[model samples]
Target: MCLDVVSRLIGLHKLFLFNFYPYVQRFLQPHQREVTRLMQFVAQASHELVPPDVLEPVLRALVNNFVTERNSSDAMAMGLNAIRELCSRAPLVMNQDLLQDLVQYKNYREKSVMMAARALLHLYRVNLPTLLHKRDRGRPTEASIELKVKQYGETDAKDYVPGAEALVNDKGKKKTKEPAEPTEDNSDSDSWVDISDNEGDFEIDTDSEDDDDDDVSLTVLNNIIVTDKHISQEVSCVQVLLGKY
Candidate 1:
């Protein structure tokens, strides 16, 4: 509930940082009760809207208090998980050196710690690959390399909505010229129908035999239409009788 509220109300994020983060940092010890929950809150609150400068200190505290070698494997794993969550939301808060150092734990002896570190590394590689070392960054595409990271309070001021470019029309655009109407002279040349030059040699039929076939076809069509109308009327009568009309 608190997470949902903080995420929805951007203003509340600052209050969370000013009030809750400091308290979490103060009690961020292995022996402290709810230390994990405190760290979780801090991580969950690290949204992209919050300035990286403000969140960096909290990230530093998490690293120093729990992610160091001095802490147990469990503590390190929890800290890494929290850091991963934080970075996933606001990766700009983390610096290159810190990120490189964190990724080194992918080779850690503890399996849980190792997995947590890999997850963090994976998150950065996907979102902010430039921050990771070249070797650890993996094969980023040309488009991914060109991806611009959004700064705090930065707005993308596009003139038009994306995917709607084709719908937009320029002012004073000239209308397309329609083709000129074909004259009698050009009609035969332009027409798609292939006319043989020797067409006058063949005898032309004034009355087509197909005229009788067309009349028969019309009669058949009328019969079909009448039969369909009768069937529909019968179905409607049945539906009305069954109170389903």
Candidate 2:
């Protein structure tokens, strides 16, 4: 529980790795009692927030001390399990050569050890397949190949709603119609006014002003239509780039 809380903190993970990890590494030997529980604790403490360089030594020590051929079958299985848990949380700590070597233990004599090795192989096969030997890597789908590993402190570059441009265009069209309706109603009422001899010049002036208003309205509507088309084209291009068809 303490490890669970401490590992969630930002800078404290590095401190835990530096001060506490080496002490746990010492007890990973075959003769040590409750070594399995100690290894589990070590795995729980590891997280992606910690740099791979800091965690690499701990993985190497576990492999060298417990997963070796000289260790008993139980010790080897425990070591492989610990490594799997560690990698599941922070796979960047493992190098290609080390991962390739560990996956080869799938053919170990003991069933428990073999299963543990195979589980490790399966985990990487889905996540970091390039680390495994080609034969062991198997066929990956296009989406799987495109999967990107998130590095420590890395954040997404683009954070926006999809189809937002379309929404904006829709709202703009609604706003343009609202002001246009009132102008149209006023123009219709003005067209019904009675004209006399003295009002003839006034009627002519009113007609000229209406013509000017019509031209301005046409210009505004044309611009809005062109803008809508441009926004639609941009949205289509973005969809194509993202493979949305």
Output the worst ten-in-a-row residue range by lDDT, candidate 2: 7-16
Query: Poorest 10 consecutive residues of model 1 by lDDT?
Result: 163-172
Off by over 4 Å in 1: 1-17, 157-245
Error of 1 at 59 (Å): 0.9
lDDT tens digits, residues 1-245, model 2?
Answer: 56445544523344444666776777777788777777777777777666788778889888998899887898899889999999997888999999988888999889999999999999988887878887897654443454565667565453333344676566668778444445876888877867666754663335555664422344555566556556656665675457653
Error of 1 at 53 (Å): 2.1
Output the TM-score of candidate 2: 0.58
TM-score of each: 0.58, 0.58
Q: Model 1 scores what on Cα lDDT?
A: 0.72
